[model samples]
Target: MFHVALTGLLTGLALIVAVGAQNAFLLRQGIRGEQVLPIVLTCLLSDVVAITAGVAGLGIVLERWPSVLPVAQVLGGLYLIAFGIHAAMRAWKPTALTTEGGASLTVGKAIVLTLALTWLNPHFYLDAVLMLGTVANSFGEDRWWFLSGTLLASLLWFFGLGYGARLLRGLFARPSAWRVLDSGIAVLMGVLGVGLLAH
Candidate 1:
């Protein structure tokens, strides 16, 4: 059981550590210091759902559906490219000292955007659900223990990412810092999209 739990924890972290839209959004929101708690919780909850589905064998079902993969990949790729372009455009634009003047994003918008960022990516389902589930299968009935560990890992990571940004809010308040952060995100997102296309 301990081995299973350890494997799950590491696997969960490894799967999530990649550069992707969801992580980019979380980082940006953290920098912006807007609705951090709700955003983080939503992300974590989303992970919970996906991970649950994967552990429960839903992932295997989805993976076997050949028609779904291409469409999902296309949509996910397009969305990533669009978001990357938008972020890059923002970086190119003049910076304001106080972004607080802009209209804050509503909870509904945040939730929708988060879902798109997370669920729309076929790769997300592939990695977190399908791949992880397949691996968990090796544990037999002990897969439950593995999944519990993975779920806990997700909770820890999301909370750390969401709330952790608060510590750097002062730096993000600086125009130069914001510029660097946004530019980095733009570059990361663009590269990820390009990689997806190549794959």
Candidate 2:
């Protein structure tokens, strides 16, 4: 069981450690010191629901309706493109960081954006649902242990990301740093969005 759990933890980290749309958004919010709690919880809960659903055989259902993923991909791709454009605009018009928490978003808005970024990404389903689900189910009766391990991975990551980002506040204090970060985010989103569409 411990071995199985360890496998789960490593797998989860491998899938999530990339600089994806979700991470980009969270990093921005964390640095700005805005609505971090709700965003982190939303991400963690989304992972729990997705991973559990996958282990409970959502993958089988998806296989039955093969069109589901493609449809999601198309929609998610378009959404990502639009979001990428928005990020690019931010990069073009960079803002200096302020101690007053400049241009902060409301908690409700932050949660909504977090949900959209999480759910509207086709890769989320691929990684969290189908891939993780298939792997967990392979653990047979110990799948729950695997599931627990994955959950722990998510818990550690989100809390660490959300809170740990605060450590970079000083670095992001410069306007140029903000521009560079937003530019990277834009490029990441655009590439991911196009990849989904072209896939």
| Highest lDDT against the true fold, candidate | 2
Give the root-mean-square deviation of each candidate in angstroms: 1.8, 1.4
- State how far residue 93 of model 2 sits from its true place (Å): 2.1
Candidate 1 residue lDDT tens string, 37-69: 777888889888888788889877986786787
Residue 123 Cα positional deviation in candidate 1, in Å, after optimal superposition? 1.6
TM-score of each: 0.91, 0.95
Q: Quick one: best TM-score, which candidate? A: 2
In model 2, the worst 10-residue window by lDDT is 94-103
Deviating ranges (above 4 Å) for candidate 1: 95-103
lDDT of 2 by residue, 8-91 (tens): 999999998888889999998888888999999999999999999988889777767878889889988888888899878877
